[model samples]
Target: MNENNGITLSIQKKKINDDDDDDDLTGCFKRLKKRKNRKVKKKEEEEDEEEESRRDIDNLV
Candidate 1:
């Protein structure tokens, strides 16, 4: 019985360690996704500004 309990405890500890590693991986992915979103938004804003400037020039001409 005692040997069985020790084996069970070790298994539980291994499961906990695996869960922590999964959490870390998800966190890293979240940060990378956020950085990608920021870059996309910046690019869109730049494109809009360029389009507006072109319109202004057309009106002046």
Candidate 2:
């Protein structure tokens, strides 16, 4: 009975450690997603600015 309790406790500890690892992975993925979104948004803004500049030049012509 004592040995069984010890085994159960160890298993529970291992599960806790695994959960922590999952949380860390989730955080890493969220950060990566945010970075990708920022890059895409920046690219879109740059394209918009270029389009606006072209329109201005066309008007001048």
Candidate 3:
């Protein structure tokens, strides 16, 4: 029937919208993860540089 077809189309549209929202959320999470990883990597690099400086000082002394 036409009524049933209309209902089915509405449901399909809603499902598509929901899928888009999920994709947006997934993208946000991915960006946050990348930012966190970059911060961690930068901190590690800074620590390594500090360690090297200490070693140089120790050698000089």
Q: What tens-digit string does per-residue lDDT give for candidate 2 at 1-61?
A: 9999999999999999999999999999999999999999999999999999999999999
Model 2 lDDT, residue 11, Cα: 100
Better of 1 and 2 by TM-score: 2
Name the Cα RMSD for model 2: 1.2
How high is each candidate's TM-score?
Answer: 0.81, 0.86, 0.86
Evaluated against the true structure, the overall lDDT of model 2 is 1.00
Q: lDDT tens digits, residues 1-61, model 1?
A: 9999999999999999999999999999999999999999999999999999999999999
Candidate 1: residue 17 Cα off by (Å) = 1.0
lDDT of 3 at 15: 100
Q: Which residue window of length 10 is worst by lDDT in model 3?
A: 1-10
lDDT per residue (tens digit) for residues 1-61 in model 3? 9999999999999999999999999999999999999999999999999999999999999
Backbone-clash count (model 3)? 0
Please estimate how well model 3 matches the true structure, expressed as its whole-model Cα lDDT: 1.00
If candidate 3 were superposed on the true structure by all CA atoms, what would the RMSD be? 1.2
lDDT of each: 1.00, 1.00, 1.00
Error of 2 at 2 (Å): 4.1
